[model samples]
Target: MWQNLDYVSERRADTVMVLSGDHIYKMDYRPLLAYHQEKEADVTIAVMNVPVEETHRFGILTVNRQGRVVEFTEKPKERDKGTLANMGIYAFRAGVLHECLPRYAQQYSDLDFGHHVIPTMIAEGYRLYAYRFDGYWVDVGTIQAYWETSMALLDPDSPLQLYDRAWVVHTRSYERPPAKLGPQARVARSMICNGCIVRGRVERSVLGPGVYVSPGAVVRESVVMNDTWVGPGAVLDRVIVDKQVVVGAGVQLGCGNDVGVPNTTYGDHLRTGITVVGKAAHIPPNIRIGRNVVVHPHVDEEDFVSYGDEVPSGETI
Candidate 1:
């Protein structure tokens, strides 16, 4: 993203604050900026204390008592007592950013801020400070992370609060009506969004807008996105179905006995190795899909029918 910094630099700003959009976080940047200005730092990085076991997934930092960042490593295999991980939020002096970003872009093939830019700035003796953030933050980088974050939103004690009117996370509003559940339908510990018509059992699942779950279908511990159609008697457990997909009657996805093997045929990384059906895909009637199987987007009925009755575990279609 440093390549895109030319616009900010051209504006002749005093400070440039950069943040990662992929993370699930709720923070007020005003305090961070104030701290940066108070320290008169050339670069200020937001750091948070994460679990030691999760150190390999983030850029770890070791800071002096003065809050001056002394050492930084990206995705280290081993970590010390310094559990402060980089939150991918930085405040840089405009001049320093403009000067260093261009030099780094020209010199290095990998221009990632955590991996190269910040480390290069530290090596050049920049006055870098660490801004300690104690709030809740999670990087939704993988499927399992996404699922866990989604489920966490339903918890009453979740750190990431959404019901607070003062700090609202706004999104594009839809004109759809309230979700409708059938007389015999049963739903618990789930979030059903607007315009969903549920005539089946939905437990510990999230249903996006305009989803239709037919009678006798069961969805548990899964996320079904917008406008999807689940036919009668279908079963989905520990699965993620993207927008506008069709699941036929008696079809099953996610065997609930996943071994968590890594596979990348679905174009996205999965942590729990759960089954994923891409957007707009069509699953034929009575077909069974095993755990960790991926049905690619826009795949035809022949793909599943060709596999006989069930798609094997860990296979990507």
Candidate 2:
């Protein structure tokens, strides 16, 4: 890992920090690096304590009381043995990175850091410190977890508050003004972002950039992503619309009435029949999409009778 880093370091003259894309976490690495330099450790890994049920999915770390790492195991069954688990965020000294990567490259012949590099460094008796992270860390790797995590942003008591000006969560900017609520709009317990024109009833839902809810449309407990158009009188419940999708007039995305009939188009991914519409997808006019159905991307078709069937429109589906 270090040798290739050395090569890249020469090409680009700046410090590099490795971050994992899967987890929704905010960590301040400046303090960790300062501590690393103060302690003069070879490597410093950020660690957080997750619930026992979730430990099997993460790399667990055992550290002594003095904050020294003693052992590292990947996905241990018994999480009770160690409370500290790796957060996959690292801060390495440039010299240490140079020394570690070449040796790692020779053994593994690949540039995978977690699999071979970190473990070998720990075994080599280099001083390693555990930087404890006490903030909110949500690994939204699954569909259910992703939905829940996004909703958590609306909670007042949520630990991960994106609205905090001091530690703001950043996303790409959209070319739109502040979200507008039309005279006919009735919104309760919902989050509406910029460029959205809401003219209907939105409850417990998240409307992303450029979403247009026509008059009399009712959206409840659903997530509508960027540039989605919810037609007039449409009723959506527990649905997840990806970027640039469109729902036709009076369409029902989830099961609001009967229970025995199943909406198999949503598949078994949804534990509680939450529907998901893929990016830039389109639904036909007056279609009833049953509970937990997932509509794929770039579909632009009309007059669909069944649930879970991908829309035939090649551009909007």
Candidate 3:
């Protein structure tokens, strides 16, 4: 991404803004750019105050009263430092970046902004400032965080309000037919996106585009993505079904009390009692998949023969 510095210089741009794609936030960058101009900053990083205990997951920084960044650490193990976290958003002077990126490439083996670039800039006495953001911003970098953030959207009092017209968050959407609910369908506190056809019970869940839930299917506390088919009598609880998956009839996903068992492969990510089914997987009928199970992408129905109808908790298929 640092290679874009050359394009910035070629375009004769005064400054360039860098943003991460995996984050969900509503912000007006105009104010931040104005603050950067006012401070005559060589680089301005957007920082937010997270809990000190959670600082280990982010690029923590210390700033003076004038908002000048003094120190920067990326994902430190001992996180007793400040809670100001780098939001992976930066505004850099075009000339400064065009000048420094090549020089830093020779100095450091890694090109990470948090680990190498920003720290080196601070050490070299560059005029770096921090723009404080107190609004709703979430770095959904982990599976647990993504699930939690998705669930948070259902909250009526959530900080991230999608219905607000003041600052609308737009996305590239496909042209699809409107979502339909059958006469027997029962849905509560869930978001059924366009192109969905529901005839089952969905509570406290989010269904993406083109999903079809057959009758007698019960999806609770789950996130089902695009083009997935929930078969009849299938019960999904605290599960995340990826795009184009086929949950067979009478399959009980996220079942059993063994929620403590973490996934065998991605234990750190799937330990929170959430079973994950990757894209295009075909789950067999009447299979009881326990908590924290991981169904890999493109898994065929024949692949479940090894499990013999019951996939125990924490197993990956």
Candidate 4:
């Protein structure tokens, strides 16, 4: 990403704004840029307050009364109470950014804004300012974070309001019709997107576009993405099913204890704290997947059935 930024810097002019797509939030950046110009800061980092216990998952900052950043820590081992965390959003004076990024890249191969760029600039006496944002923001970088944020969207009083006409989140238009619900379907506190067909029970779940929950199936506390097929009598709880997945009849996922241990066979992203069926996977009938298990992308019935009818907790397929 830094390498690509190097090329961008070459063509850019006065100021540059950087943002990470992994976050779930609503923000009008015009104000942020105005604040950056007002402060005349070399770099302005958008920050927000998170619970102290959750600070270990983020890049934390200590800001002075004037909003100037005094200290910066990336994913600190020890929590610092009342500290603001970096939102991975920044507005930089283009010259300052060009100066820092190339020099850092030349000096070290590791090139990330949080891990190297920001801290190094602070140490070099660059005037870094923190733009406080007291709005909803969640870093959906991990599976647990993604699941929780998705569930939060269902809350009537959630901080992240999607229905606010003033700040509409526009997306590509899907021509499909509204979600269809069967006569026996039971849905509660869930968000079923367009083109979905629910014939079973969905509680506290979020279903993406074109998802089909067959009759007699039960999905609770789960997030099922686009075009997935949940077969008849299947059960899904506390799980995340990715796009184009096929859950066969009577299959069960996330039915065991939540305890999990690390498995090095799969990548860190697949080692979610909850069960995750990756995109385009196929699970056979009557199969049981325990909590914290991961069925990798495009995995067929043969690969999945090799683990037998029941997958032990924490095991990845």
lDDT per residue for candidate 1 within 1-317, as digits (tens), equals 57677688578779988888899999999999999999999999999998899888889988899999888999889868488899999999998977898899898888888989988888999999999999898898778888899888778787898878899999996899999999979999989999999999999999999999999999988999999999999999889999999999999878646546545465347536578999999999888887778888998788776799888777889
Between which residue pairs do clashes occur in model 1?
A: none
Residue lDDT tens for model 2, 85-135: 888887776667777787677778776656677777889987778898898
Best by TM-score: 3
In order, the Cα lDDT scores of the candidates are: 0.88, 0.75, 0.93, 0.87
Q: Please identify which of the two predictions, 1 or 2, would achieve the higher TM-score against the true structure.
A: 1
For candidate 4, the C-alpha RMSD (Å) to the true structure equals: 2.5
Backbone clashes, each candidate: 0, 13, 0, 0
RMSD of 3: 1.3
Q: Which ten residues in a row have the lowest lDDT in candidate 2?
A: 308-317
Pitting candidate 1 against candidate 3, the one with the higher TM-score is: 3
> Model 4 over residues 144-239: C-alpha lDDT tens digits?
788989999889897898889999989996788899999989999999999999999999999999999999999999999999999999999989
Candidate 4, superposed: residue stretches over 4 Å from native: 5-12, 77-82, 258-273
Please give the distance, in angstroms, between residue 105's alpha carbon in candidate 4 and its true position after superposition: 2.1
Q: Sum up the clashes in candidate 3.
A: 0
lDDT of 3: 0.93
User: Mind sharing the TM-score for model 3?
Assistant: 0.97
